[model samples]
Target: MPVPSPYALLLSNVMVREASVSVLDSSTSYWDYGPPNADTVVVAVHGFRGEHHGLDPVVAHLSGIRVISPDLPGFGESEPLRDLTHDIAGYTAWLRAFIEALGLHAPVILGHSFGSIVVSAAVAGGVEASKVILVNPIAAPALSGPNGFLSRLTLLYYRAGRALPPKLGGALLSNWLIVRFMSLLLAQSPDRDLRRWVHDQHHTYFSRYATRDSVVEGFEASISADVSQFAPSITAPTLLIGADRDPITTVDAQRRLVELFPDARLEIIPAVGHLIHYEKPREAASAIVEFLGDGAVAVSEAAA
Candidate 1:
């Protein structure tokens, strides 16, 4: 049996708390893990079609420092922005405002998949962060990825969902089979149990968007921007946790993308695709713990 992760914190534990904060006139629901008093705070952003719960696997492998994972506007329990387009600019602004609202002081910022683009843009555009971490970061355009053809089909899927009437659109967007199919293609876990869990996760939470517009617009936004655009401006040291078999950006692309940053290191987990959080979360967490240094342990100790 695989060893239990060292920095591990179980998701089922009662220690995980739910909290909320108002940002941009909307209530953002978040999951708080680790000690509330832990000085190092890492605000995590979930991927497209994902809520805070999606990062539970990776977060479970991390402790000592507090992690705040919010459901992006319109996903999970969060409401959509009052009057902003759901584009990169809107998300970038929301993330910055969200952090400020929480009174975080240069907390480490982490993002996964679609979230990576948002965090990268926010950090590059001047939302302060002590450090940066990108999991399965999108290095290239979605339409130009290794799974370019499938991505194009997915673009069509989103467009179709938007064009159809509300009931039909929501039905199509929330189709369980499609979710499982997409999950299968991207979830490269060889372990059957892990694969089943990933499929279950997608089935349970992947299509929980508040509105058809939110899902469609978010999909468009996700494919529209990538970390490459913000890499050069992110002055803080960054870590990119990549996968050798990632269906979207290849490890080669990840390598090239890391070089563009002023200070960034790439960690490529083998035998996994985009779902590093599922297939190889232990490795991802190990890389992050090392990048963060002693769990930012000094902060809590100093405060004490």
Candidate 2:
């Protein structure tokens, strides 16, 4: 059972806290590059169905910066949240704990796709980071209105999916079905390789824990997450990077995100897809380098 190349294994360690709470019960893996003691630290969070391997190249190109790209819970070696409440908010809390556990500075929090949702939640909840970068981020609509529809719909799907027998649940959980759904909903130009990669990631990482109940709970939590309250609270300078051709998180959504932040900058990458960080990592790293080089002041200047 060889896993996908984009999903390289990094670790299998767990976290156990007092009061019998096993904070992290799975191996936490990441694609770490750059100097450990570098003046600036950067943490990269992967998107839905994404793992650390996709970030390896981006992390590698970043020098003179301490980079930590962790696999999100249930998505990689990091175990799923107990009872399946692993929504974006729970993921944000877990990440904050992971950062504190490692005793690393807040540094620059960079998120791709779904990771952007969690990053926004973290920043809104007062997770101290020097700055923030969102690369082709998803969950943009969550920031504004008709806000409860997606979450409630997800909860409904989970309930419907679970009513069926376990054997039949396979269809709902099938990679083909999932990829098709994504192709129709998220990917504008769905190709064979991209479809295969999506399937490979789901099979390797989410197949087991992604039961009807868990997914339902995950959806319920994600949709119910109140990021609008969190968005305005963000004090860190924020940068939103979008791919011109991205289907998941479009340029329009990126522009809307700019309105939510107190201080934010938007950059549109041409000829790229949703995974801007993976597609042009060196350029992505360079953006961070430039951001870090000037401290928080440049972000204001750039935004203006």
Report the Cα RMSD per candidate: 4.9, 7.5
lDDT of 2 by residue, 62-111 (tens): 54566677777665555666643677667877878777767777778988
TM-score of 2: 0.72
True-vs-predicted CA distance for residue 58, candidate 1, Å: 1.3
Q: Tell me, by lDDT, which candidate is best.
A: 1
Tens digits of lDDT, candidate 1, 68-127: 999999999998887887889989989999998988889999999999999999999999
Give the distance in Å from residue 169's predicted Cα in candidate 1 to where it truly belongs: 0.9
TM-score of each: 0.92, 0.72
- What lDDT does each candidate get? 0.85, 0.62
Residue 211, candidate 2: C-alpha displacement in angstroms: 4.7
